[model samples]
Target chain A: MTESAAAPSGPGSTAASPEVRRNPVSTHPIASLLIGLLLLASIFFALYVPLYGRLTPKVGAWPFFYFYLLAFMPVMAVVLWVVTLLQRRFDTEAGGPR
Target chain B: MSHVNSTVFTIVVAVFILVTGIGFAASRWRRTQDMMHLNEWGLAGRGFGTFITWFLLGGDLYTAYTFIAVPALVYGSGSIGFYAVAYTIVAYPIAFIFLPRLWSVSHVHNYVTPADFIRGRYGSRGLALSAAVTGILATMPYIALQLVGIQAVLTVMGVGADTTNTYLKDVPLFVAFVVLAIYTYLSGLRAPAAIAFVKDTIIYVFVIVAVFYIPAKIGGWSHIFGAAQTHFTSTNPATGKPFGTFLPTTKKVGSTQLDFVTLALGSALALFMYPHVITGTLAARRRGAIKRNMSLLPAYSVVLALIALFGYMAVADPATVASVKKTGNAQLSVPYLFQNHFPSWFTGVAFSGIIIGALVPAAIMSIGAANLFTRNIFKEFFKPDATPRLETRVSQWASLVVKLGALYFAVELPKTFSINLQLLGGVWILQTFPMLVGGLYTRWFHRFALIPGWLAGMAYGTLAAYNTSSPTASHWASSSDIVFGFSLYIGISAFILNLAISVVLTLVLRAFKVPEGPDETLPRHFTVEATDTPAKERASVTAGEARPAPGV
Candidate 1:
């Protein structure tokens, strides 16, 4: 565990100790931006009613409204996983302990 | 009472006994050296890893109510019930944004509850007290809702007494509550975390089997949906309106598309703010564990979506619908549907799953409430020099008191009252969002300003909820209220009012040069993760020395 701390620290850590590795979200703007956009897209997809609330299209005996919401669960899992991965890029870039 | 299936009842009893044993034994499951601290009792030592945290949170968020009531709503209404699914889906991304920060800051400062963080950030015990009180209030109904879930299962099982006296009628529920209280007292948060594994597995197995097997046994998915559509479209003789909506309607005056959107959004915002959810989050091992679980926890939401389909299944099966209508309780739709469709032994499994489902979350909720009382109320106000052992002891006894308060809610009140109170609990808890979540990212909002903002949100939410009524009840009938001819979730509307008040008051307070309370946190503190050894040191140190500044 101590050996894993040998990473270039980001700005989050003020101690400047050799053992302390910073969390990357504090210094990585791109990661924060990507995560911010993903959050917005997620909220939009969830809250936008007219987009998928219609009943014409049915998938596998389920109404489009129900299917759209159900499908968004897995899609949300994937998008959040992508965000986690994007955040991970900062961890690797800063060589911080994950 | 209807005929009790001996086989099903016997199996459920057996499973209940098995879980009770596990709950008692969990005290030593992940044994820490010092067991008398609040960290061990209230948060399972705050050392839960990714896998354990996953199961624990999955079991925490998706409770017996989600299993029973979401489907019950779908059976009663229609597409509006699917708002639960949307709320859960959106809840993840929202949690993804704030939970890591919360975990990090709490970990660094050894904050035990959200109110502890509030007190530290805003330097106001008054604000912290408000948050603490709201958490406990919101949590009691939620815990009672879990009991209602158990009652629905027991009622369907023919075990509930058909008597005039409430105590005689609720003997089974009381017995279950006693066992839960004992085990939770013995094991604390570990009791729930350990038992969550069994509860979730049974739920998954039964829900998956019921999803595939029951539809085929009744008719098909197409047949079920078609029946639901037809039934909901037909006019009811009593009210002269359709039974429910096949899809969310734009033309409707009350239950329109906007209500659906607001309900979903409001519920999503309220989900993570609940004290039990925060307890689960704060118990995780690392910052990354929280993030990983957030991305992964929506798998349970998929299960929830499938569970919601059972409402349509109940609609498709005429016998189940008839039985539920005969009882005048839509909450029994899922249990009756399961009993009618599955074999006696499988019915036992499903019933036990729901009952155990209630137990896990109830234990967690009581613990959350107890922690608030111990940390924010008891220690903060009355006992300044309380020791770690005393805190844990007080929290243990406090968990019992909290459970009994929830029991009063479940027994004394009507089921509709309890359910609506749970919704009202959502509205009340969401008022804390600006102060708790806002404090995480910024401290610009004056601490004094937040107090009035909280007051405004609480007053508006309570009055609006009190004024709104359905045909059945007078006060706290529904969570949404009409605003500008559009029905909106009261939580969202109140939250908007809360933020607007806070912003205006903050500017005024700033101009008048009101002294902002000392912010003990640095920016870097929000991103720090706990090292294994330092976690123990911090836990012991904070347990001994932590106290809010005097006379804030």
Candidate 2:
């Protein structure tokens, strides 16, 4: 029933093929963490944010909750993207698939 | 221009054509020899890669209820709706722990459904039947809720009548659903799996654009928050009380912080128990895919967090409030917010996005429920020797029948109350947790014992939910109730009772040396990857043929 038909045939193993090793590369943790922290900081700054100068008129339809929730996507995406990288790193260092 | 402009009509037509085409094409996706097999039909050959899986699961988890309903709750009730946000946040991390294992065990054993696993593990057909019934019942209303979401979008777009009776006004919905049902029956799970990509793309783009554009139009973010604070903190003339906190001001707002935590925790435990979610997870090709995706899927929760905030944005915008008040339908809050602010063409785009969003999940939920009926109830009791083709046929018809059933509920039932029942669906689905999730790690609890516990939980959950009357309906009106001198999530309480019964019954059953069913899983099978072949082939197959889990 599974697509494991194309992979090496094994009854008990549910992992990727042996040669498919390293599980497609991902960005490293160092780069990931830097991006995440920076994004989080931006979100915090934006929170309770008031307009500054001529830009004082908040962009149209850009309400707080809408902005905040919408803003969460990319911020969380970067963080998750980083965590994914870090996890892949750990997975690799731990000797790839079991 | 009196009618929908050509562009609006064209967009709607395109969506309909594309969706219907996918539905038909899905019938042949992957072209399994046994097109009629439950695995092939209900679970889309159960071998989706990461990208497809992501889209499929997204479509499953995030529904039109999610886009329309969550924000509506935010628009209507304020902070209480954020429970959705919190629940979604925890759902993935919790699933990460058990789902991969469930997938592996199911994969190795060739289990078709969660109930199949329960029966194999505990050797109790009765308990499996209960799980099947609960899953079907919970999922039916959920499928119905998607129809309601579709109807809401359709009605708002003027695709339905201006003042027609609700049913006649729902013709557009009925038409779209008939098309959906046919395609689902014809194609099975593949249609939804393929369409999820389209659904998620539209939702992501629309939501992202709305989040940025809507805020800038509504005055700055601070001013929006300021308006919301001023509104919620103000005294309610009718209740003579403050409206509500944008965030929970008290741990015990209707539910204790413990209740909130327990509710979140209980729901996290229950998410994958919903047959559809499992259908999505198991449909994946690898256990690592399941594990890795769980970690990755939290990114959507961030999207969800934003979705929840749209309710607050509705509160802040005076024009938006005026539109919602004139409509007197809070369900229209998010849609009207867009209609009032966005250009007409973009509104059409947003409307289509929401409608498609509902359709993708509706297709999956129907398929999941159909699989449960076919595999667990129909096959187990009606025809043990039923062929894959027969099973697929039964499910296809059954999916159509179930959609019609949900349509009736959507049209006839009080929408708010049934939506509450969809929450009650959580309580129902959670009953299967101990048997399905617990059985994965340990067989300590006797299967028979677990059954009574599950029954007790179901009874108590149903009663507790029924007795929970709010301002509108009597009985089954609210999800919270007092238990053990504390307000708690009814699902958690019932789950505890269920577990207690299972534990006590297991102890009693063990003393009698009752025969337990044979477990198909080898111990190491739970921890390792399941290769395509049986253990016998390891010596003969190509290199890297997975060894049979040693020592089982």
Candidate 3:
């Protein structure tokens, strides 16, 4: 079953070349890199508690930690939107039909 | 059981009947000639637009467990429970990176389940079976948690007889479960997608109203926070430590900052790994729909942030606190708060919202687990020649069995056990990340290596979780444990071990010139759009491909 299924794709060795060309993120390298870094930074901001986990700076009733986490949601939405836009550029550059 | 509020009970029953009607009628929605295939039954025909996709994905991801459990956590602990908020926030960006690729690949290949994708990618039925088992295992506790949410609401409504017999006591829950099971069997994913509209509307209306009205009714947000801070800071006599910190503390003893960070990261990573979430993602019509929904879904998280504040509201209300304390179940915190603060009709609305919320996700989750069973297990092992009609029948029955198993867990086990098991579910599901997500970008990790890595992670996670105990319970007391004198989420720790082991073993396996499995997918397949009808594609594949090909 597996062998016949593998037959159409020829062999595993020949499969590598097309995979390299079609790598999604490699099409727009700089934009993908920036998007990757933005994703990391967003995660870092949310998780690095030492940076914002404090009570002194309170937004209304929210502590700094709570406010920071809640605020990051919108920021993340925007970051992800930008990433989507960048990926769209990559998609166009690669001449992939949407 | 003791005193049923006639108005609230009547309203809840009315709304529930309406929801059940919608659930059954959803089969006619987006009417298709063939509802026998996995795509129609499991993925709602894979043509959901942005609007329905948003509601379905939102409804699927944020279960009644989130509604009941997040606040319950905040009511019991303090700021650390806001890890849910942080997790949902970060989950989007992470999902944005991979979910579209997954959707595109699954669409192009007509893959019904993640395990199907894993099998095709790795050419290892054993690896795919492992993924299927983990998905089903993780989802059982999750479905159980939804029932726990419903049970909490029913207990608060005083619906069942206060008998010594457990069966009589849970008659209402049984009735609710039967309705959900029947509708799901009839309508499959469409039931949840159709009903998600009503569910999200009721939730958004009630939550928005409660956030505004409840705060004003209980002095203000400032007062709620003050009450919470005071309550959490006070010492518990049993533990001789502070109840919890109002803010996450840097100290080592309780609710440590590291625990908060790790829990958030671990949950974010685990959220998309759940088969149910992927089921929702794959139901969408296009990759762009998924990407758009990823950005838009955070709107639900904003609502979740406000919902978490209900814990603070409960803390502020002395009546709510006294009622929850009387029941000795912190899960009832939000319900008690609602019943105390809102009018009878509004209480009914909120309760119906929560009950229906549980129903929607529970249905979707069962479908997800059932798809895994039918596609990766039953079809893979038992009946390779199964027809699409047979496959759908098997999945429908598998969903019912999965739900019943979850019902048994919810009814028999202690409530805390189900909640802790849900945490353990997150841990168990994270073990699959390397195989599922790693296989997406690169097939470098050998499938053989991934199996052992997953086993090591699962074994280490279970043992670590078992070893950790608290004053209230022993064995699987919490999802966080002390690692090298710092508290960390057990999932992240286990994941680190899983990844490291897989990487090391992959190097070793390569050195030995092991036969890497045949790769059936091309890189272009991951970005493929739905140019032709899915049925046409499936037919073409069936005509061209070998009979034993894993994905349809």
Candidate 4:
């Protein structure tokens, strides 16, 4: 890391290079992909079961739309955690990948 | 004006004064030798790391628009309004993929706005100016919408009780804006950056408590859910349509599961494209902070999801619904609900929470608009050798003027109409997708082709949105219009048109010898490792904060 008063600092590294580095690999991927699939199911139920003309019995005291949406949050979060892990290829260094 | 109790008003004023003092002092926060440069004024010296970035970006993102408008839409529309929730859920994964790359490239080039990237990438100031103009124009009304959010709180708080005159009704709002304008003018980005800490804390406390306490008071979760379901299923007397669907459907009404998914996807793609979010991201010290913040941001989204449910709570309570109907102001549903249910002190806390919620993002939006004006408009066309101090000065004044203009929008425009205009804003903002986000992954679209494509999209979106009307108001009331048999949000349809034109024109232009601009940015610039590059490398970066008084 030579100092050049006129050399450009590449975008992000000028800040902290903290001691506890983030692992490039996340906890899970296949699970994350599967979760995304499950989420589509949940979101569909949220939409179809409530909005569709004469669907099925509602989820709880809760209607399908309300029930599925609240339930979808945790599932969505899990899937995002997974997608993020899979997409770790993008957040890597300027020279790391094309 | 009972809700604006004299005691609370005094306290709010004193706190605002104290906060303003702290804000003006923030010019010196994390002190550097000089404070006149645009970097210091606009990006807060660009030295923020993760912790501060979280609060700052959080402040910039979850705005008064989300707090007031989302709940109102939910209250009025029944179920379709929750698209905001889904859009928010998807925004993170969407941002996680590209934001870090943007951070790297913008940092490397010292680009101040998204337009800066366009200008550098394609060597076209016209294209850059188009993007900048689009961002600023869309954002002005947005800032105004935040003002309307504050005014709704004020109107509910009884701050405007004495006056039928519009000017008098907005007195409290006017005072807040004046103070906000001054602090933002003096402190620049630091004003919002510091105030975000206070705003987020107030919001988290009041919202968490309200989410719990309100449900119990309304006869628990079961009763709340039951009431909402019953209400949505009932056919409206006016339209004979059930209020709205709480969920998506396979059956197409121009609106379907596909519409839901596409709107979510389109908005998720467009979220960070707004110049303000980029300004917030670039101010951070490293790329990792942006990545880390994406996961952490859902913590706020959880709060937002609860906030949306406030709409359901409003729907379930018959008295609250009766009151909203009497006033014909659904925007006051949350404010009225709090007033009726919560104790005075807690209501004040909640009141301050929503008011400050509007304040934080209002500051950021104005600053983002000002940056566009200074960088793309002022610098590009005016004195190319404009001093950093001059640019900063012009931006400061521009921010004050923008807020004042938005203030007029809030006070002067009818509430129902302003909301429709906000939908109009959603339409105009989506037009920029081709240049800002599309160009990130590929440059296959020629810049020449892209410009006309952008214009076509803007015209179609504006006209389609303008023509959209319902029984409630003449022009801007309805969000859905049938397009080719499917009910859809106008923004998505318009964006598809924009992309189609750009793609077709790109192939056509390539057939001739329309030269593509030099690519100063390489593929790696989009994926730079944070720790791998040292601050020492930046020593030669000519874009470093130039001296204030001299010719920059």
Candidate 5:
């Protein structure tokens, strides 16, 4: 971390050499796409009220709407957890964390 | 005077003092050579780890408003109130996508406020000023809502409910706010970040116990849901209509399904834009800390989902209902339920939790607003040569002024008004989305075009909110109104209008070959890690924090 100060800094590198490290998105397109999908899915299940906003189906005494929201929390946590790991891997792979 | 629970009152006061002591002591927590820099005072030296970030953000986003107002809404209107739950659920993923980018950029550039980022990205002072002003304007009512939350707790404890004289009635609330303002001015962001630990612990203990114990006391989870279902389904004698839906439905005229979805989506987007939440995110030590915290912060939402059901629990316990009926304020439902069911000693623990919950967010918000004023408004426009010492001092005083303004809003406005004002705040802050969030990914938005887009959205949202009338109040009665046949949150509606105008005008401006402002940030700057930036450069970046790039 302390060695960053010694690294060639700023937009100057882009003009100086063709070997400049690209932005993370271009460097890891597949991982970036997967992260986007994971995020969008998390948001989708959450906001699509019709998917879980009902009462008939019950989980132990919770109405389905209530149960779904509670259950969705863990699912979201796991999904974002996966994305975080992927981001860590790519950040390291893309020239070792900037 | 109304009957005061001595046990509850004592514990509440004791907890208040404990946290107040903690707030002042926090300035020394991560000892630094100098406290005058905005980096130290306003951003807590930007060294918070993942655990502290989780608690700080949790304490920040799930506020006293979430505790008191959300349940009150649920108690009054049944399932529509759960939009808060849905809103919180979605806020993480949305923030997960944009916030890390913001964190990286701000760390690289030493941008202290969202408005600072706008100024750097667009190189437009007027647009940045608009962002700063909107942030401070939107945040006031939100701080006011926190005070109102504290007031609800006090009123239920019967501390001032007996007094007919208004001044006398407000003395406890006045004392509380003054204490909060003093510590916040003394310690800045550290005050709230420190107090958040104690506050969340107390809240977790009480909420979990209340969720389980209260259901057991009031007859089991099935009975509570059953009772709520039955009550919501029953007709109101005065209106000759059902109280509210037990579940959000697509069948109604002003369909709640659309309202639920829009409210959840709009609030999720707006939550991160609030300067305070941004302040919380920017305080972390590393960009990765924010993403890790995003997954972890939803733990608070599970607690929030349980808290919202306090409304249903209140419904199931008829004595609690009858008591709230006499007060004529549904915000008292949760407080009253705890007071009625829990032993007085335990009730004291819960009441203090709610009070401290209000204080933590209130402190962070004022600090957030103050940072915006110091960085974007004061330093940007008035004092370009302001020293870091001067900036921190100015921010301290600005925080006090912001808190005082919020106190006035809480004391003078109808108690119900703050909720809508907060939603109206969401309406106003979401207008900045195109400029702040949009500028992150693309510079295609013409700087000049964003101004009118923001103006149109703010004007339309304010007027729509002002003219909205409910059965009880003449104006500012609701946050949602009919927007093209669907009952949607006004913030979402205005955001669409804002985005459309920006896109249309950007095209025209591009066609005309108008000059785009200088962009200070490089492409890699948006993805730069803390470890990537040199410590010396990071320390010096604040010197030119608001200055535009030298050239394109």
Candidate 6:
């Protein structure tokens, strides 16, 4: 069952790997790199506690730590939004997902 | 009874009934021809677009855990509690890397649970069972924690029976659980998916109101932070140290910067791995919905950051502090803050949101755990010939059983015990990362090796968590322990150990030429979108795919 079901030929050839075979990254390396960097930047900024974990640099009444956390969410939303667009463009250029 | 406000109690009860009615009506929301199939019942027909998916996943993720526990932690421990905000922020980017792949594969193969994908990819029922068991075991305590959240709100409202008997006192909790189970049984995934709209609406309304109004009422953000800093830095008569950190320091003990970073990163990795979160993810109609949600869901974290500040708000308001100090449970801090500051009617609305917040996630969680049981354990081992109808029936029954178990955990065990187990749940679920997430990118890790690696990590995580102690408690006291003299989250440490063993054993298994389990999935399965293959095409292409061992 496992052996035979795995080799499904009809939908397998058409729906699955056409874009992957063309390799979206190889064709649009800069877009892929930007997406990667944007994602990494989002994670890096949030995880690096020391960068925002201070007391003095206050925004309004919030300490720097508190202010930074509240501020970081919108920035991350925008970063991921950009990454999504890049991936969409890259995937479309590489013969699209559908 | 003396403490109960009739107005608040009536309002809360009314809102709860309205939400319950919504839950019962949800079965018809996205009507499907066959409600008995696992995909329809368990995964909401796998047809949720970006909008509903956002609400479902947000309601699933933010939870009562966000509403009550995080504020309570911040109230008690100070800056360390903000790890939750950091965790939610980083979790999106981390999930963005892999969740869409999981979605695509699950969509292509009609997989309803993470364990189903593991079983299909690794071709090892044993490995799949481990993933399934871990998912159920981990989810039980989480569902229990939501009950704890509900109980806290009831306790604050002075709503439960005045009886000295423990079970009699929890009449309200039992009532809540029964309604939840019935609606979930009748409506399946659609029930929670529908109620999530109401849950999130009430939550956003209350949280935004509280963030703005509470601060304005209690002076302002500066005053709240200043009061919190003063209170936290002051010496505690019990411990002879400061109450907690006003700001996380580079010091060796108590909410260090290192501990903060590790907790954030570790929890970010573990968040989406939970079966309930994956259940929410796989329900999306398109893979792109998952990616878009990865960016969109952080909007909730903004509210989470505001909610965490409620701890400081509680500290800043003396009436709230005094009320909570009398109870001696930090969990009451946020509830007391609301009761003390808000008008009776608004307090009722906020309390209802808290109760319903617990319900939405609890429903999703029970369904997720049930799917894992039905797909990987029941059908895999007992009834391989079970029809889709039978699978959905088993899942519905299993969800009821899971909720009952959670009810027992919440009512019988000490609250601290459930809290400790939830912490361990985070650790236990991370052990499945090697198999679930690893198999997504590559199948290089030998399937046989994953079992022992998982076992070793589970064993070490359990014993280590057991040995951890705080000043007030001797066991199950903390989620982070010293590793190489650095305070690190046990989940991250156990995950590293699990990965190391997996790598070493894979090398050994490869050298011995052991048969790698059949790779049932092709690379294309990981990239396929729903529109890529029409339903008729998918059905014909993988004819009899749902039947047990059909090709054989």
TM-score of each: 0.95, 0.84, 0.94, 0.88, 0.95, 0.96
Q: Which stretches of candidate 3 lie over 4 Å from their true place?
A: A1-27, B539-552
Q: Which candidate is the best by DockQ?
A: 6
Q: Indicate the worst ten consecutive residues by lDDT in candidate 1 chain B.
A: B543-552
- For each candidate, the DockQ is 0.42, 0.15, 0.41, 0.21, 0.47, 0.61
Q: After superposing candidate 2, which stretches have Cα over 4 Å from the reference? A: A1-10, A13-98, B1-9, B251-256, B530-552
DockQ sort, best first: 6, 5, 1, 3, 4, 2
lDDT of 1 by residue, B137-197 (tens): 9999999999999999988888854566778889989999999999999899999999999
lDDT of 6 by residue, A54-73 (tens): 99777777889999989999
lDDT string for model 3 (B359-393, tens) is 99999999999999998999899998888889999
Candidate 4 per-residue C-alpha lDDT over B1-552 given as tens digits, one digit per residue, 9 for 90 to 100? 654676455545655666677677877787666667677778887789889999999888899878889898889876666777777777776677678878877777667788877876666778899999989888888888888898888777778887789887778889888988988998889988998888889889988999889988989888886777788778899898888655566677734676666666666667787878888998887777787788778777777778888999999998789889988888899988988898877787778878888888888889889999998999899877887779889899989889988888888877766677767776777788788777676767788988998899889888887787777657665666669887787788888899999999989998895877654554445655554443334523434322111100
User: lDDT of all predictions, in order shown?
Assistant: 0.87, 0.73, 0.86, 0.75, 0.87, 0.88
CAPRI quality level assigned to candidate 6 from its DockQ score: medium
Report backbone clashes per prediction.
0, 23, 1, 17, 0, 0
TM-score of chain A of each: 0.67, 0.40, 0.73, 0.39, 0.75, 0.80
DockQ of 4: 0.21
Q: Write the per-residue lDDT of candidate 5 for residues B64-156, one digit (tens) a residue.
A: 988999999999999999998999899999998889989977877778999988988888999999999999999999999999999999888
Cα RMSD for predicted model 2: 7.1
Error of 5 at B521 (Å): 0.4
The pairs that clash in candidate 1 are none
Evaluation by lDDT, superior candidate among 2 and 5: 5
- Identify the CAPRI category of the predicted complex in candidate 5: acceptable
3 or 5, which is superior by DockQ?
5
The true-versus-predicted C-alpha distance at residue A88 of model 6, in Å, is 0.4
User: What is the DockQ of the complex in model 6?
Assistant: 0.61
lDDT of 2 by residue, B77-195 (tens): 66657667657655664565578778876776666688977876666679889999999999988988887787777656666545567777777788888888888888888898878
